[model samples]
Target: MRIFRKITTPSNYHHHQLRSYVSTCRAVVLPSFGGADKLQLRSDVPVPPLKPNHVLVRTRAVSVNPLDTRMRSGYGRSIFEPLLPLILGRDVSGEVAAVGESVRSVIVGQEVFGALHPTAVRGTYTDYAILSDDEVTPKPTSLSHVEASAIPFAALTAWRALKSTARISEGQRILIVGGGGAVGFAAIQIAVAAGCNVATTCGSQSVDRILAVGAEQAVDYVAEDVELAIKGKFDAVLDTIGVPETERMGINFLKRGGHYMTLQGEAASLTDRFGLAIGLPAATTFLLKRQIQYRYSHGIEYSWTFMRADIEGLIEIRKLCEAGKMKIPVDKTFPITQVKEAHEAKDNKLIPGKVVLELD
Candidate 1:
């Protein structure tokens, strides 16, 4: 008679299975911050093991933001220069390939669209992107991957300013400066969805779209004097331009105790200039001075807002997209192999709006 032997399965069996499926994937890496040519396409970038709360997305599409191009051209050198060879993208629309042991919100093969936080190091400019469960949500069935990818980062930024920072409510008046851009247009729609009356400044070409989205007033910044044209005080003002001129107008338009937010926070820029040791403290002190000055003199709150990952906000945005109430039209798209060209278009302002990269 022959001896028989049996072996029990290993305790870490699940992780073993996942790693086998995602040992490596394709990605676009930026070894150094420079022009569009600095971005490189790599075939076998290593995929690290997923943490228990994270999910692995097999990316199909990713939209380019101004941040992506800025980072490529050395925007956050203080933080990013040390961590070179980073994959540079934030917005992603794709299907889940694998989930961590504790992930329950989504299962493998589920279609999802979401964005990473602005400071995330490992981005979505790759075949596989790792995101926490809260950062990914079910994709809106009404939109394609390319179209869906265009919405998240911009919409989330708008949501942060209006809904989270400003606390805008129904029947209140909101002013959005530079409504022709993605974040500005999203703000207009978001405030409208919240049942607030909205007024915005945009170019003549964007007037119809702005009005169609339910903005009560559309003042062309180029053709009209915005201050003279727009009537009455607003409960909140979101200044996308963030220039001295727009900033002054935004603060002046607000009601007492109303909030005024600008997207151009100086935290990162200061850090890039002075390095993290001294720059971070300087940025915080500067922000405090402005906040106090506005509170005392204008009887309003002033803030520098940035995009943050919020699950509730992402789910609500999906509902808006599904209902055809929120959208960001894509100006153009390029395959992942043509990422350089896509980035070049953004830098050159060849396309007026969003640019997306597609992967096969």
Candidate 2:
């Protein structure tokens, strides 16, 4: 069901600004990795200069993800420490303000949305941001900037897990864990649209919502044992909640030769928990060992998914959204200045879908 049908251009759409005029922009910056208090609103941040094959976008809205919270808390301090005072957002929807010398896929004044690669120094939590042309596409005509901003990261994760990793085919049976969350919500729709029999597990409050998104069955994981509730076998199990027990249950739900995928992978290791020096390597080895062990025991493939930005995949998602086959579920919208409150809301599980930040 398409909740939003009337497609319109972003309200802030404007003509191109000359690249020669460099200016400062406002952004939410993480000065140091810690808690929500570390997320500071700074107005003097300078927007990056236009580079070849890139486009400068006047940010309209940005979506908050678990990754943003993790990054703010220094979850990957070992890798991201050198990039302190970083902007922490990925999904963005805005109007192109200027284009680089060689950019061709998009033009100034075009409304676009994309998930910025996580490695980028500048992220979407700003008044202006630059993105490589190949990483973005025209915003779906069926959604507004606020709604479009909520989509890219979660949708791309679902797309990669189902399309790239699972290679889901028509009539296949797929079980998606954590169907109440954004990624799981998107996975249900993408799988259902692909002609698969989709079953999902969520809270009792989320059952109706998950089913409304075309899930054939919605099991309340809080009330019942998921492994016992889902009957028969699934062709693939996509687990958005990365936990060892859940992963084991997912493997049990899968049929012989089926695939099981999780989002966390080895990042959630005991070594990391104990603050050991071998945390990273130990976690990687643990994941590898599990993958081999599962393959031999159950004749099922096991893999972890770390979602990446892919233009082709985003384009397919755009089509699905425009055609009313998929919908971006936004739970709440907050001004960029209220980023701390937004993060707290998401961390506290106060929203069913995405918590977005609207930029001026």
Candidate 3:
């Protein structure tokens, strides 16, 4: 007995429906930088809109880095201050959910992993993330998402420091300072894979692990002086620990005409405590003067490096993982909800290897 009316749908209804599908997702946000306690889990965080050169990904796992903890505590405040309420993370392993029109290399549903540049403001501590196509590569079949997630940032830093900066060559002798941490561990493997004779310094407990990872010699930094315990000069020195004294000792370990590289900025000493205004020029001049002096006195090349995401370098890492030439050592895995605990663990040095956060 009811009268029927003609049914019609709005022309833009489909578009609205499509938008609803990706409107929002859960994410760990930093409302303001201070401590791990500042990270808040929010379900209504908007998904990053796809840009012509970006790909949207459904994050499966992410790893925490020292940078994450430092960023939370307001480190590099001058550089990251404007990006407050930011998502803090770098390494990501996930499945592509959608791609920008211009993304041709990766298709929807493909597994991928990469290190997000910290300055980009877009981070991996979320249900979805936007990644530039060139920064990511297909994840190796041999690695799980959790394992792959533990790689990129640390491994890329190691690769760049050893391969690009130091130009480590086959049969060359190299010294890696601070060999127990994630970046140090990866450097050990990458250097060995390149056929270099590797020597590293680690805590007494980590000596065996470092040697097991292919280091020809592992010095116990806690128990002995690195400059005295290790004999002979190296073709190159890669210093992951960036203390001024360490940098000086690293130079001493380098052979004439050899390269000395550090992952931390040469100006880190000034920059960490002072703003770039003062630190930038001072660091530049300090390094330049040291380079000139070292060239004349030791004929050594000194370079300071900051890690950047590189697609080709990532591909090399993937190939190494696939070939069993590289391995990611995971110390522990926590659910995304336990992010605060994860950060605390890293801050307290509770675990060795990389700490990972599994999204699923």
Among the numbered candidates, top TM-score falls to: 1
Compare candidates 1 and 3 on lDDT and give the better one.
Answer: 1
Kindly list the per-residue Cα lDDT of model 1 for residues 136-166, writing each as its tens digit. 9999999999999999999999999999998
Better of 1 and 2 by TM-score: 1
Candidate 2 at 326: error in angstroms? Answer: 1.5
Tens-digit lDDT track for model 3 on 1-360?
121222322444322212212657888998887877889988888775677678777899999988888888887776777767788889899998766656777877899998887666768998888889987889999999999998888888888888887788899998989888888888999999999999999888788888887899999988887777899989988888978898889988888999888878756557656777887788899889978988998899988876687888899999999998777788899999999999988888788668899897
* Least accurate 10 contiguous residues by lDDT in model 2: 1-10
Off by over 4 Å in 3: 1-21, 266-274
lDDT of 2 by residue, 1-360 (tens): 111122223334442333333367788998898778889999878775566778878899999988898878877766667778799999899998777767778887899999887667688999888889877899998899999998888999999999999899999999999998888988999999899999999989789888887899999988997777788999999999978788888999899889999988766444446445777678878878988999899989998887687888999999999988777678789999999999988777787578899987
- Candidate 3 CA-lDDT value: 0.83
Q: Rank the candidates by lDDT, best first.
A: 1, 2, 3
lDDT of 2: 0.84
- Would you estimate the TM-scores of all the predictions? 0.94, 0.90, 0.90
Each model's number of backbone clashes?
A: 0, 0, 0
